[model samples]
Target chain A: MTPKKVIIADKMNQFSDHWNPRVIGELNGQQVRAVKLKGEFVWHDHDHEDELFLVIKGILKMEFRDRTETIYPGEFIIVPRKTEHRPVADEEVELLLFEPASTVNTGNVVDERTRTTLQKI
Target chain B: MTPKKVIIADKMNQFSDHWNPRVIGELNGQQVRAVKLKGEFVWHDHDHEDELFLVIKGILKMEFRDRTETIYPGEFIIVPRKTEHRPVADEEVELLLFEPASTVNTGNVVDERTRTTLQKI
Candidate 1:
């Protein structure tokens, strides 16, 4: 099958909703996703999956139990499995996420923000 | 362990060599790498691994047996397993690569450019 190149900015413009991630690329049982974030996310941790968050626009505050990391554009943070954390964005932040396909947005928490099924853009 | 955010640009500044990739982050069984590319790469294909190349600076020409795809900054292309391809860059190009940890720089062929052991930066 022929593979196509994905333009991150073009995909980001396809969605504006916060916290919902859209699948853009998939390979090696992992998915590359694009999501927008504003305000705060629930504190949670994945039991078996690690998540990589790459900032595309604005700043992201990744809060762990002990400290919060401010990630700017061109920066990325890998939240290890079983480490409870939260993501906070004072303003809308665009991100590209890399993780296993089984990873849930809300992780271990089944909150209102939990997304079991994601849309592909 | 406290997870640290990796500044891609800062890590990129640490290396200037072409074609050699340095591991920047790893999650699950996958590795995230940063590499600078110029000229042309050998035509090769992984038997079991898919590779993702995201352009960060300059332009990348991904040549397939059938056609060529031009990838720009903020753009990415996935080379599926068993698909012979080559990467050509007229000028220096910065890139982020995601693939399995065991992936070699030259797949299916061993050349002087083959990197069996990759360094982590």
Candidate 2:
């Protein structure tokens, strides 16, 4: 297989959807997905794998049930497995997420925010 | 446990060393490290886990035994497990690497290039 080098933002423009992550690359069986967020993400967590969220652009606020952390463009936060966290953005937010290939945005909870059909490129 | 937030670059000034990666955060069974590189990294690969390299400040060139790829700021590349690769930079480069917490920079092969005694913050 030819090695993949992903310029995530450049590939993200090909689609126009919020919350749905498009799988861009895989490493060590882990899938790298880029998601676009506008308003708020569902309060969810993956119980099997940890989720890594890197803010590509704009400010992102990750709100837990009690505490919240605001991430800037150059900042990133890792939501541990089973930690109920909701990501919110007052403005448009671009993010790069790393998790297992089977992980869903909302994990096993099926909802309007649950994106299971991940696109691979 | 107090949640850790790493402002990578802002903390890097506390130390001055190339190739030595500082353990910043860990999630699940993996750890997040930030390393400062100036010249060229050794031609080596981790046999156990894939290496994720994200360019934080300058350009980076990851050379493989067969092909090579250049990564610029905001770009990332994942070197698969056991894929012999080396990273080169003409100027100082700031990078963030994510892998298993037990992963050594040189991964079992201790040499002059290998940097051990990782600092935790």
Q: Which structure among the candidates has the greatest lDDT?
A: 1
True contacts kept of each: 0.85, 0.37
Q: lDDT by residue for model 1 over B53-85, one digit each (tens)?
A: 999999999999889999999999989999999
For model 1, residues A3-112, the per-residue Cα lDDT tens digits are 88999999999988999999999999999999999999999999999999999999999999999999999999999999999999999999999999999999999988
Against the true structure, what is each candidate's TM-score? 0.99, 0.91
Worst ten in a row by lDDT for model 2 chain B: B1-10
Candidate 2, chain B, TM-score (2 decimals):
0.90
DockQ of 1: 0.89
Off by over 4 Å in 2: B1-4
lDDT of 1 at B75: 96
Q: What tens-digit string does per-residue lDDT give for candidate 2 at B15-98?
A: 778888888777667777888888977777778888888888888988888888999887888888887887898898888887
Q: lDDT per prediction? A: 0.96, 0.80
